[model samples]
Target: MKNQQLQSKGYLMISSTQTIRIISINETFDPQGVKIVYGQGTFSHYSKDGLVEDSIAYRAKGAAAVSVAEAGVNASGVAIGYLDIEVKDSDKGYKNKICTLVIRSFIPTTTANTTFVPTTSAPISPPASEENSKQLVNPVPTVAASNGYVNTTDSSNIPF
Candidate 1:
């Protein structure tokens, strides 16, 4: 399937089919003193129409929390990572669903001394010229899979 960044909303089953750029990481503790880590980043994916972009915030706990913390410590400015999130029916009286964050991979940086500065303006796409015609079309065939999953046969055309 074509790789795409998973959505970061609660009560949804999602996973990163491709690596995502971590713009920032923050660490905190829960009421019980358990460590929690939060990562903020931008996720982009190619849709049948065009490029789709969204802001993502992921929370990690337990073993995943430790991994995110380690990555944040080593990262000079940003980090690149993959995440898997599963939502299940919650047993807690106060909540209806529980979300779990799994860190598949986390790297401090892809290039030396690199930094990411988020802009308030929308992303500018290249002009639709003849040379860029191929990029304007959907690169893969997508099918709706069960449980809110989108499947693509060729992920090679997915833009990271």
Candidate 2:
């Protein structure tokens, strides 16, 4: 058997569903956080009936590079974590498959607070594309460096 390498591209045309989890965030003028998000990507294939298929296997692993000030203004975690990714699809036979998906232009609609787990509190679940004015308190605070706590975000200034 020959060893095979694979890569594919999925396209999200018009609109698609996406979900992102903020693993960790650091305090800074422009705070950067790690995120793992998956959503319906570009159409990688089509059925015999001319129906298109969206790939959920592909994901965008990137940073939530937003500012505390910006977060305060938006008052939405989903808005703060919004991202635009451009990369290959992580699916079987993707490398060998023909790619027609526009990876760079994939954007979702109506991002809201679906899941949030503060360090100290239980998980917070809110509806998508809605506003929740609940305050968030960091249950487990991080160590302070010369600058300050990296994962620290002033709850008073933010709305969860």
Candidate 3:
């Protein structure tokens, strides 16, 4: 019999606290007929000039799917948490590596703060009234001026 070498064990890759605005959550059956749930959103942060946005996604299955649902990620809203990825052997083969999102703590339908400083190049005005403000789905969070870092407050349940 030929000896087969095992692939390198899976390990965490990148982990960062991010403010995500979940645009949609989708559920579908995989090729194996297993239910898979995932979501697409935008990751926003403040730069030296102004707010910046980027697309983000997460896959939550099994009990994690339930937790994501409970966290209210099913709708369009803001959530802040540690978004991390793990490099692991793909289900198809050991030679391939798959990056999977490791769900940490996510508090949904909430804003980290209510302060925003628009870029000087393109100025943006705040909502005119309370009614108008209520319609804004993506609310800017407060970032530390010195280093552009925002604090994550809801970490009581986070393991690390």
Candidate 4:
């Protein structure tokens, strides 16, 4: 079936195998007053070289944001596995999204989930590469003096 038809029926699927190391979750309100739990973290995907750095600000805010927040808190160093992008009906509009992170079976081990270190062989040159793909991944590390957090991604890639 076509993706659009599938989406209309309340299914959003990402065909990639991905992983996310959640750094932080914050509760905020949208202008429309909906509770938005913003999650920012590092992302990696299985490549021929094993897990390679993919993006940052792996924001998953919406229906599953609450769960993401909870997991981050209770599961110290929680690593969300088998992550996928899903879209369902929402007040916002058709195909409103919630990044769905699933647990296949066993719980994640502590070491893998705690920290996110970029494994990109080269530094990310932003606004060019990211813009072409229309997805914002934290290509560079933020200065420590600025904020304690790793870094939030640019606004370009968030599909909402």
Error of 3 at 106 (Å): 3.6
Poorest stretch of ten by lDDT in candidate 1: 1-10
Residue pairs in clash, model 3: none
Residue 45 accuracy (lDDT) in model 2: 44
Rank candidates by TM-score, best first: 3, 1, 4, 2
lDDT of 1 by residue, 37-126 (tens): 876655567899799976566666666566666655324223234444335546675434332234544444443345789879888998
List the global CA lDDT of all models: 0.54, 0.34, 0.54, 0.53
**How does candidate 1 score on lDDT?**
0.54
Worst 10 residues of 3 by lDDT: 1-10
Which of the numbered candidates is closest to the native, going by highest TM-score? 3
Candidate 3's error at 42, in angstroms?
Answer: 1.3
The true-versus-predicted C-alpha distance at residue 159 of model 3, in Å, is: 59
Model 1 error, position 109 (Å):
7.1
Per-residue lDDT, model 1, residue 71, is 56
lDDT of each residue in 42-82, candidate 3, tens digit only: 77678997988867777655554554565554343333333
lDDT of 4 by residue, 1-160 (tens): 5456776999865543334555666777678775556545565567889977644444444545555655664242343434455567776656765554443222333432366687858776767555567656886556755677656679898899
TM-score of 2: 0.21
